[model samples]
Target: MKISNETIIEMYEKMVKIRKFETRAMNLFAEGQVGGFVHLYIGEEAVATGACESLRDDDYITSTHRGHGHILAKGGDMKYMMAELFGKETGYCKGKGGSMHIADATKGILGANGIVGAGHNIATGAGLGIQYKGTDQVCACFFGDASTNQSTFHEGLNLASTWKLPVVFICENNGYGISVSQARHQNITDISQRAVSYNIPGITVDGNDVFAVFEAVQEAVARARKGQGPTLIECKTYRWRGHFEGDPTVYRPEGELEQWKKKDPIPRVEKYILDNQVMTQAEMDKLNEKIDALVEEAVDFALASKFPDISSAVEDVYTDIVEEGRSR
Candidate 1:
């Protein structure tokens, strides 16, 4: 938990970036600039930011469907993210992967899977790779509470723990798995508490509190890289948006949404940074303006980028071409 003033400032900026990016992307989606399900990671910024602050440049991370926050926190580029959302050819996957399947290898972001809990196994496999290669790099897998019910969640954690793999299992219990409340989903109130069964240390943190999440992750990651074992960190947070872009969420309770809104990570981190003298308020304002302008430019770039030609629509099907060749 030895976080310096510099690290706090970076975390604050990253949380702000996530909120603004999600907000702008929602507006663009409404304007018809994007297609497919756009699940905004508006409320869960601090979870990704805080957890990933513990990772290094070479450390890998896998993301869930609602994963813009993880990608940004893991140092993903805004221009490519915007382009991918817009379905432009300049996207991370050259516009093939869309909103849910964004992957940036250069940043060590393995990918964001559309399927629930898919990234869990992928992250486990990555930890195995790290173990095999004898690298000190760690892997952080971001999954929602709904994903915990999925088989991969069990399989991945079991494998990671058995092998004592260097992986951080982050469960973002945002209180809902697309309209199903935590009360309805699991009997256990604290998802982190389940780590005891796996023989790994688990911690529950206020996901809205960026510093707390960051500190907890720092410890878990240090332990992981030391080859001790994986850690299960359940971040108690909320998603500001609906399950997807077009769902009018009549499912959520009235005051609960407003209650979580009071815990917005951006302002909380901003105030913490300023009040702690980590950075001046003027500097924070200037940084925000810079980030906003960068996002705006990314949007424009995405709009101006070329679309993938229809001729190659089926070109990326690897097995199809292999099967055709085998027929010869």
Candidate 2:
């Protein structure tokens, strides 16, 4: 599949945005400006950026805990995300849902899941809804390698396959399920192989290659839109940071992360752009400066935003039972 130069540049920009956002979030966490468990998607930017580029604005996506990258790629505003991290009322969830639970329904983001493999069922249900409505919409579900072990994964895949639901299961096999390495957690080398039982197309790709990921997902999205069953795409990538911020990552071998850094997706894309003469070095530099400023502005916006008022704690939480009874 031939991707246009414009699409490639956009994908590169999105990858850089994810890198910058996560880098800022990391520093903020260390400086005590942000709270809660923050999982950084430093090394896995390509997977999200490429996959999201293949999706339409009306298409749906379900993200995992390390979801900031996914949301941003799917057109999430950095200002609102930064506010949510700061627990400000101006956030997407009104300062209620933190790092792992941001959602933008208007943009087709079905919320990031805190529970492992929970997106499987949610994406399946969304696919079912699309099928019922007879729309060409498809839901792309993102999860980690270890999440495949969860019961929801099997159940969701089985049901979606049986019904030929328009869902795409994207497994980001980032080598570890939290602290446990892939070899330790699951015996299978390729998580995509799991799709065999469900009789769906299963593919494993180099997650670090943005174009490769884009092509694979574009094909899968097309298939889903055509009413075919879900496709399992295992992106074999690695996360530079620990499972969450402040995690020392003592479990990893000393040289493993350093080795993965050699294959950094951002640099790879940069090299492609320069080699192809797609953008001059000066243009790239200007783009970087612009992204840096945008991220800084988002930080400023979050800091200036107010926190959610304590009095309204139960406002969006429960139904107004008294009002409902009176009305009835």
Best by TM-score: 2
Give the per-residue lDDT digits (tens) of candidate 2, residues 1-328: 7778899899989999999999999999999999899999999999999899989999999999999999999999999999999999999988999999999999999999899999999999999999999999999999999999999999999999999999999989999999999999988999999989999999999999999899999999999999987999999999999999999999999899999999999999999999998899999999999999999999999999999977556566566532222221
Question: After superposing candidate 1, which stretches have Cα over 4 Å from the reference?
Answer: 319-328
Question: How many residue pairs in model 2 have overlapping backbones?
Answer: 0
lDDT of 1: 0.90
In TM-score terms, candidate 1 sits at 0.95
What's the lDDT of the predicted structure labeled candidate 2?
0.94
For each candidate in the order shown, give its overall lDDT on alpha carbons: 0.90, 0.94
lDDT of 1 by residue, 20-78 (tens): 89999999889887889999999989999999998988999999899899999999999
- Candidate 1 weakest lDDT stretch, 10 residues: 319-328
State how far residue 244 of model 2 sits from its true place (Å). 0.4
Clashes in model 2: which pairs? none
- In candidate 1, the residue pairs with backbone N, CA or C atoms under 3 Å apart (3 or more residues apart, or in different chains) clash, namely none
